[model samples]
Target chain A: MMRKTRFLAVFLMAVLTACAGAGHLSNWHDESMDFGAVKTVAVMPFANLTQLQQAGGRVRDTFMSMLMATGGVYVLPPGEVARGIARAGIADPTAPSSEEVVKLCGIVKADAVITGVVKEYGEVRAGATFGNIIALDMSMLEGQSGRVVWTASAEEGGVSMKDRLLGPSGKPINDITVQALNEIINKLFK
Target chain B: MRSSTSFLNRISVFLITSLLFLPGCASVKAGPAAAGPVVGANFRVAVYPVANLSGARAPLKETRRMLTEMLRAKGMAVLSDEELETFLARHRIRYLGGLSAEESEWMKGEMAVDAVLITSFEHYDEVFPPKIALTARLVSTGIKPVILWGGSSALAGDDSEGILALGLIEDPGRLLEKAVGGLSDSLTGYLSGKEERLKGASWRAVVRRGTEETGQGPPFYFTAEAEGGRVHIGPFGPKSYYEAPFLAPGKRYSIVVAPFLNASADRDAGDIVRLQFVAQLAAIKNISVVEPGVLREKMLTSRIIMLDSVSLADADLIFEGLNADLILTGKVEDYYDYQGPNGTPHVRFSVSLIERKGGRMVWTSDSSNTGDDRVVIFDFGKIRTAQGLASRMIRVIVEELFSGPLIQERPKGVS
Candidate 1:
């Protein structure tokens, strides 16, 4: 009976941990700036703080594709953005200053600039089960004033109930990344 | 004891019957049937090397051999593979998308071939329920080469799966044979003048997910809709334009399909999309697609690179170089193929047509599609390859652009 109680306790703890890591999202929008005015935007290279080498690039690409797919705005081609960055003489493409952002927008002929950061990406373990997790933050800056109009942060994926009960059958890393990006996109439009 | 023995006998009969009908579970859907030879039995044809755009290393030699066999089976003379290779090497000709007017005339003089067959292997999946897709076009070689016929075929292992999942194909080779065989039959039918156009595009347009209602918070340029729960921009939106209102019917127009800008993560996606457009546009009866190789060569020699859209200055250069009436260019947003049993292919791109004379934008279109767009129940109509899906999508776009008002016999008295 004592051993049975211990097993149940461990099982309960695992479930609780998974529930805690489910998903999170936070966003802030400035009503003063009209998002409709922003017809074209440039997505700069995302900053990667995680251990994964290409996590930043991967997440940024997904965000751009998903955002463009939304049909809400026209996302400039990466090659054109690169050329704009070079012409603008921006030393840091990943994290651009407000002045540099304005310069880039001018050269690319975009109304806005979008920057992103990949904080956490890859597998995370909760109890005995392992699953994919992706956490990211994104911001939109106006072209003329170079002021941030919208900001959002999102985290998705983790060990689920099914995963804890039955071995690891969680979603793939790509799916996790997409889910996280989708959450942030929803917040942007919201 | 007698009753028990009777039960055993009944069970045995049931088991034996099932074993007999097991093989019947697998089914085959024959493509367009082959008609009699209409290209005269003495016509000599050369099959070029199979273009691999599937993003996976395919069995090129084997596929060519099968195509050649199918062509010969229809009572047409096909140049040997070795001889074709030797000719290609001797001429140092690598571009296989389409032959130029000069090259076509030269081929008529040297090789004496009446037509050339260009084939592209778009998708070849080796996993369970193996899927294969390919496109073939026959262009005549003379003073000016014209696309005689074009056909595409795609097959998935579970396409014909009946109840109980009995008809699952595990062998990729069998799937390839069926796909190739169907294409051959379709080509033969077209050659015999029995099948004019293989099959019109019947797939529905990419739909927007209901969950993503255009956000009311901000005034946006166009309503955004997610096709298959994935974001897909304009073309279906309110401002999307179908055909070039300025296009004249029954008039042959020279077109140049420029390389698209790749916005997706996939490598060479722009090139792949460009070739697809070239192949389809060439098959249009009223349009003459310029040789892609010649255009690429000119672009290289002139050192012209398009940053985003084609500018007027660059347009003039293209006009002066090739006398092209319209320049077709766009950006490929996404071109991806999922793996495994439940994976689906996705493709998205937008195109624009620019007239060279005044350098004005005449037409623009956006397309997004998934393999499972129209698939319903038991995956009966699922497209398993990105190439198959893209071809279907492009076919619809092209047909809709040229159909109805654009190409209708300019009203009896209005011309």
Candidate 2:
């Protein structure tokens, strides 16, 4: 009886651990727009909605790195993006107007522009478990039409069973951020 | 079973206690605030001596030099220290503690400065993990000495061991450079009409706490807002300093290269400048520079007197005869190819450009070196030779002249 009870408890713990913060991801896109047509894209600075100072830059960098790693699209260098922003005299990089986006695309010779907002980032603790959470929403605007062709939002991160039971740490914030970015990029290409 | 239940209960209690004591990891971030548009396009700024309020001995002069270079790179005309000293001495001003209203007026009349940048250090340590806290204020020298912009920043040096593990140098100089670079970046970001969001706690509050602990007051006033561990400063308007480019980029223009007149005592300086000017111009794709031999032949055939100082009339006559779009003529204001006490090579010169038809002065650049310039190591390497320095200076001049909107060939179907 004790053996069976131990097995049942272990199984339940495993199930709870697997489901911890599985991440809710949703995406929207303009179906008429061809995702394959985007040959090059410029990732603008992301707006920060969280209290973390560098959350926007950190998430944007991770997303850019992951998107570039996929080799699906040519990503414009961040320095070039900065120069384009300066030349375009963008009042707000995070929320640039369609005109500014088109101007930036023209300056950097990108087919599309990617921008996003970092809604949540950093550590959160519940009960005895600690987790590093990141929530992000990204969108790609087509240069020719100055309209958003694709958008994706994802919130991910939760303490693993090992962290809760054994006091072992979960994945680093950067790793979690990368995972969240991969999910968004997967949906973006899909 | 009783023992096991007790063990589970203990574990549960421990988890609850840990949760109750969980530390808050919240941080604050400040973004750029909007400000009015910048008033002027060009500004001549004077950076006063940085007062050291940090009890620790800091390299104030080195920091000042670095800030000067940064400002110059941003296209600001920074008055050299020697010029400042000369002006102060001529005015019988023995000590420049701070800029009073009267002194500001005097500076305006004497130095023709548009702004005065005052800086002070509250904390600067050079230990294994260096720390630097600095405050800067840009005061306009207009009729009223209004504070155009202000900022304060604090930087804690990165762990040397960690940096070394990442395959980077962790020397004290590098740490200090990083700290100073951050401070300069903040200052320039404010001055150039961009907003810099500072992370971490309020540097002013931190300094105030330190002062409270040390039983002293902060050296400078705290005008910046600090809340939720973040300090928000200025948008400070757009960058006003402008250097007119000789010609806009992407357009091909024919230019006549005139021999540079030697104004310096160095006899070969003129030749060096002229040779470098022609060589660099030849390398630029958008500029079609007339060959030196061709230019001389044209001058001789056109009966144009090639004098040291070409007047507007002379420039017009030459332009009409040669049918060139622009004339590039300058004087070698100064040139020195010598090694410093530390075996560092140095080169300095000044050059200017003019439009041919209207004889309008378009661009001018002067190189200044005080032998105190810090050597910056990059992935590519450092400038080591006089020729390299000359080439670098010429590149800066060329970039300044041809700096504007980059012209791109639009696709057939795209606007």
Candidate 3:
């Protein structure tokens, strides 16, 4: 009886740890962002892998909102650089050329630019039944070097679509955004 | 007099040769194809999921062998087999998992993979209680797969077309072979459109009809080089227009680069623009899409709404690009009913319509019955009719968009 209880305890701990939190589970992989004496970070328009057009902008806003809210890193507002793109006539706003990224940095007046392609977003559906799944990818880069300091992608397959579809309006990927920040925020400072 | 006549004849011959050869060289060499600075000519391609059909797992050996053969047929120096394995290890996936556009760009920039193809497909049996129909769809990571024209078939084992057997039908292998052959044929047809043989660098384009000189329109006459793509002028036509070659999935790096250099040449590229727009709209149709293209076209034009579908991989790209007042995107998915022992009826269907925004989705109605699944076994026609599902999704979505910022009037010409 004592041995059985001990075995169960170890198994339970393993299961609990898996379900504990994003950081604990994510530490298996080295997903950290380091600014390395760089202060200002220009968050480029994140890629939109979803069907939604504004997804990239929202991701940009979320990163901006969360980071700016933290009062740690200086974020460059897209509105400030919209003019430069318009002037350069980059028809597709999201797909800024490397030259364009550099030019936009000049306008934003930032030391580094954080930009990456939005890897994915979608729902898990069984026929008409719904399953919640939301995913995002973010990368922070230095403006001058165009080198990525940190890159991370997150995907959530079991998002609990039942709750959102059944209950009131709610953001499905808010936790992803929060977790994304938490995953890299400290690493950048360090 | 004989010497003067001979001299005149020699001069005439010389004049003719120069006339033909000089202009040919000048026109061919004058085009922007020769103007742009050479960017990264040595393109490195990260052929992920090379051996797999879609992002999902499949029999690696057979499928990959076939896919590699196909790429080799295209003269693609795709990364060697070992390189593909290394890439898979780096990306942390067993297969390529179908890189998204952003991921493709990142790959091109980081790993120097000029292009990437992400794919997903399902090979399953649809049981209509007694009858079983087998189908497969090769979907791009983000866009709906181009049905390859022949992936869907109406034949079963025993080589008896349209006959559904009780047990696993006889000659199941041959039946699938026929289906795949048909599918490959269609994919070839679609891939033909992606061929940039006549693709050019000039910004100018014309929608030409057949001329009297040649009975058929768009006929080729001679061989010439246009931008990065090769142009063929057929023996049939006197007139042929110039165009930049279309971007084929298997080969895009060489094509995309030329356009980047002479930006003006591709600025008004109607083909690229139309295809990109179609890509945007096609996403909607693939994501649990049931409606005919007509309804989508009508609703799209009549509203300030931007619409499309997204796979799990590209949720971020779609989200970022679609920062309109409202955005609509979802996925195409299905479920299997494994009740019976070996004969589980696979009700194949695409169910998706989530990740909505603008605080819409005001209402939703669920209709998944316990037994009924993706394959409407008995109701064959009903199940195939996408309007039942796709349109309903649109109705909910349309109603939501029109609710607020998707307002019809633009605040009395604030402009």
Candidate 4:
């Protein structure tokens, strides 16, 4: 009887532990919009709000690379996007207005556009423990209508209990970045 | 018989001794012919003070001393620093970025200088993986100073890393020497009628993203070579339609590079990029890039200030002042260098070539890069400095701008 009780306790704890690394994810999808119609997509430079200098561009390039790897969508070249931004006279590429989005999409001939913001990137510490973290929020807009068809957010990496007790063995920033972006990408496709 | 044997032995000893000393005599005679400058035949080059456009403090004295020594080593008669100083002081010449027409005449008549070399120092970093960027142009010292030769380059310690980083350069002094040595070699090559040509190489990293319906295979193609490893998987073609047709075969054109606009955080990034482009453009045999100092002087005298993009009227004014066939200008979006172990340099910029006759953009290109862009593994192809990255980027863009079939029809307007 004691063994059974212990087994149940351990199994319950295991399930909870697995759920810890899931991070925070909030997603919105428009049921009225047809996602199948979207083909080529353009990713604008992400807006960075952290102390990290190029956290925005770095994350955007990684997310673009991962998205391109999935073979689910065609991502326009960054140079093409830059050319569109230049021609459209978009002052701020990170946070373009709906009208600018339509014009940029037309210029690049992209079916959709994705813009993102990096809230937190780099090592975060809670006194005794330290760990890498990345917080990313993205929105996909319909090229023709310039309306948000889908939006998603994801955060990954933090000080775990093992880390606190065993001391911090921080992961490479790139790995944490890939994890965060992968989670968001899965959510987008799902 | 014994006397005859003694005579033969003496003759044998004398012949061996003579042969041993003959090579030493020959080498002593060959030294000047092979390496030293020929008296009265060498070009008398006067290297001016380095123009600082880096927006930061540079080791100008040290750099100039090294460059002058290197130029002299290449069998050119470099003017002594003392003489150069005396002349500048006498003429009260504060600006050394370029020589004006009057100054050129003075140099030819009074100094008997055959050519004047103007240099611009762009970026110098003494951190790990030491880096240096500079451009030099040799112009004829006459009433009309025409650029006879020019070269711009950047060097970093970790640029040519081999297995386990065996080839990485860690000394800033060695790196500087290599950078200066390359320019001297190029100048000597030109003087000897052997123009250096760049081998064909593609700098673009294409990533092909095939849709699910196409049923394409893998997402990337990886190739590991002996020099530097590269991984590319993407659609093959031009990234954008930014370029317009440029250049006619067998025709030479003169070009003026206007100051670039800096949107990047780095100070004077615009000027750094402008000088880099000028350096690359001047090296082409068919194109003559005006000395940037000349252009700067003209702009100052004409009271022309370009707030943003160069206006049509401004272009006309520049054309009138320089009488050049084309005007090259652009903006630098990002020029950043990361520090520490995982650092990588990133640079992004765009350029456009405008026709003086019709005021149309004849060629345009946009380039962005990072040090770790295409490294498959082991960081073989990583770049460590923004200057080095910019040099590679500009070379590729210039090659595309000048090479290829001539397009007779006027390109459609950029939308």
Candidate 5:
């Protein structure tokens, strides 16, 4: 009975998160190259905005899962490209531009690239209330386009450490990601 | 044959019932319970040591000294480094963690010590301001080290540049003094109790309900919570003089809402007084809504969320910061007392809320509710219970303002 209740709770949370996602994603451009035509696409390293900060590799991992889970696409290894950048002695480890973007695609030999800026990642704590919010805006281009195609971004906002550890919250992190991914996918499809 | 079987069942049921009641009776028997002051054989602790974690050349002497002095002041016969070192050597104990019960027994046998306190300071480097990080802990033989208190504080040191450039505080003596003192006081209250058990791990949270600085019983204060042998409630950090003691975490506890009367009474009177206050506090939305804090997490989840609990000092500083949309205040007036024809006691309480803007009260609401109206009465005299009073108060207050429509916006669940 307890396990059943837990399962029901998770299902309910997913629904609520989907519901909340509709509000934040309203912009972006998806250059309509047939995603169906491309079996595998390479996602280049993302841009680090807002002064200089490292958000760990979780951001990259999240994008990988979010993109693949969208269907009709597959991602090449990010590790191989990271090695190429290292071999090339890239001065900046966090942010890469158009030239580096091209070089990265060549190293991985893939269809396209995705890149973006991390707008904010902060933890606001006051009294007994604690809130963690992470927001980023991303763009996907034909690896060499220098022309932006699909761009969709979303903000994950809310209070964590609530009723249950990793419980249903005002705004869940995963929900926000799915919302942004859906809107971006719509543009890609369009 | 049927009568015999029925009689046997009754006897079995009676025996089972007695087994349950006996524990309850022993719990409340009240025979000068001997658990407070950590006499000789207590075996749990959290030692938070804040030092230089930042790879800077700042002196950690003052912080280290403050720790030893503070623990000593708390009246625990703590072990010195030499003694701790010798004991560790004797017991062949290295890496102070991951010890089995047999290993623990060996250590205790060899060292004659049940637990040891270990802490380290992290991240001490600050360019303009003095940033200090401390980790305090208390570890026993088998239990994992619980962090009693660990956080970094930036004392406005020598940088006169103010907010742009935080200055390291010239003397952290006072700040350390207050933080330790508050922790000590909270520990004392938490440990002062008689314990009985049923279920998972438990701890006691005690907040002091009292008069304001104006000699009027309005704003409230809190003592730190003692749970599972760990103390929580940020050491009033830089604020020293208003410290409470270290607390004990026990499942069974008595929460004295308003101790204007005897704290020992387990009857309706105590609970009645508590309920009246809750109803009053809840009527004002900003004053208390969807209560907060991990320590107070249980309270908000309770049928009644405690509201009339902001002390004058805390409230004053909070309002002075000009942070809240509006400051709120509340008070309890006379209780309606009468005799029942059946020789039962009945009580009712009155309270009011005042909103503070600028320097004066801008809005006020008066409310009163009978205690016995909600819960049925069976006896007289000491007639209050935390649950009974809190429930009545919660019902009244939540209905008036805690509803979703009344709030500014639906608050996202607070972590």
Candidate 6:
């Protein structure tokens, strides 16, 4: 009887943990912001912290695709965003000042500007397990007030037990990146 | 039973891992959306030179040319570079920034334009994975030139690597072309109606209902007002000096040029006018023009020294002699190279188009550089000689006549 109870308890714990581990999403947003007023948004370059050289740009592209897919926003083109950055004379595109953000928004005629950082990306290996991973942090700043209106951070991807035991066939980097992006974007909408 | 329980545990672990790695389940609330501008067809607009802000040296002129073509394809009457430049110079407007109320009224009264379009390039590069970004705005030329419609778009080659790798886009130029093509489509779509896709790619746009003011709404809706209604009473009563009626559509007409009469003191004014008319008429695709050489030979052979205004009988005789549908005759009323006050050169001339069937006047128009017209600052005195003024005068007249609704339709499948 003791053994059976222990097994049942372990099974229930596994199920609950599986459900809880679907995503880890944390967000911070200013309550005073009128999101409805944000009709246009410029997506700025994302800072890359990973070893991969193109990780930042890859993640940024994914975020742009997902954000535009939401249909609630008119995402300015990346070239336009670069122009706005140049016109603002931002010394550091990844980390711009509040004043720079406002100036860029005004130049691009965007209601808000979205920026992000790619924390982790690419394939990883741990002993007998292997998988692709992606982690990102994103923020939205209002153009007029130059205040951060919304923010979200998320991390996704890990080796599944099935893959680990069955020979560790990892998912593609692009797939993992997209899944991680979707996870974080879901938080923004929520 | 023990072995079966172990297998079940393994299965459970597999299923749990799969579930954990799957996409997350989150719901999004409805957010705010933007509306596109509603504009009428055939609105006359002037596109200012694109302001290049891209740190790189991008081909701004090519981009402007592409934009102009796209606007024309959408049935908008875009002003030529010469015309716009002239207007700007005459008014002493150096910058293309937001126009003041007084400047806007002046443009409206003088140019008879409905809207002004301004475009700025934010980023443009032709390097590996070329990139381009631009923003455009259409402002009304009303009492206040408020922004009526605007859009911004950017695209990079890196964003389309998948398509490139798949051999969809063969070269960098093709990729840039695709990007600009998408931008143009999105812009035109926004102007005409709401597009379901936000960007030009596969992403679908969320539809928002109702007009929620964000302090960016247009001042007023635009209506299609009657165009080219201004009439000037020249020596003739209430004749069109700046506007001409559009020619009948779907008709092809052959034109025979008769030498214009040199009413001015300058000896070469008539020849200059004649040469300019021939050159301009040759550019019209639908109108078949008899070669100047052929017409000159025929005139010399017939001993026709027809000068000044040709009488109806003489016009009819020439029309029959040349087997022409229309006879275009003109008089160089005033051709003077003014060199003194304010340093502005002026040219004035009048032209009349006569139908061959009854020798009746079909169209008569005249223009003078010395009028109160606010936008005639082309080749001001120092740069303009008599020849230059004559060329400009003829060009202005020809453009006014041919660019109107008077155009022959191409046969099916030719375009």
Model 1: how far is B291 from its true place, Å? 5.2
**All candidates: DockQ:** 0.13, 0.01, 0.01, 0.12, 0.01, 0.01
Q: Against the correct fold, how does model 2 do in TM-score? A: 0.34
Best by DockQ: 1
Error of 3 at B52 (Å): 8.6
In angstroms, how far off is B154's CA in candidate 2?
Answer: 16
- Candidate 2 residue spans exceeding 4 A from truth: A1-11, A22-32, A65-109, A168-171, A182-190, B1-84, B87-123, B126-415
Q: Which residues of candidate 6, in runs, are more than 4 Å off?
A: A1-22, B1-415
Model 1, chain B only, scores a TM-score of 0.75
- For each candidate, the alpha-carbon lDDT, in order, equals 0.69, 0.58, 0.34, 0.69, 0.37, 0.57
Q: What tens-digit string does per-residue lDDT give for candidate 4 at A1-190?
A: 9999999999988965763344788999999988888878989989999998868866776666456545467666555577788789999999888999999999978899999999999998867788888998999999998999899998888766677668877676666776777778777878
Q: What level of docking quality does candidate 3 show?
A: incorrect
Q: What range of 10 consecutive residues in model 1 chain B has the weakest lDDT sum?
A: B202-211
TM-score order of candidates, top first: 1, 4, 2, 6, 5, 3
Q: Summarize candidate 6's per-residue lDDT along B164-223 as a digit string, tens digits.
A: 243222354654455455545655665666632111101100000111223322111100
Candidate 1 vs candidate 2, lDDT winner: 1
| Per-prediction TM-score, chain B alone | 0.75, 0.38, 0.36, 0.75, 0.30, 0.38
DockQ winner, 2 or 4: 4
- Residue B222 of model 6, lDDT score: 8
Indicate the DockQ of the complex predicted as candidate 3: 0.01
Query: Candidate 3 lDDT, tens digit per residue, B217-332?
Result: 32221111111111112211111111111212222111000000001122222122112212222222111221112223233344322222222223223333332222222112
When summed lDDT is taken over every stretch of 10 residues in candidate 5 chain A, the lowest stretch is A50-59
How far residue B110's Cα lies from its native spot in candidate 6, in Å, is 45
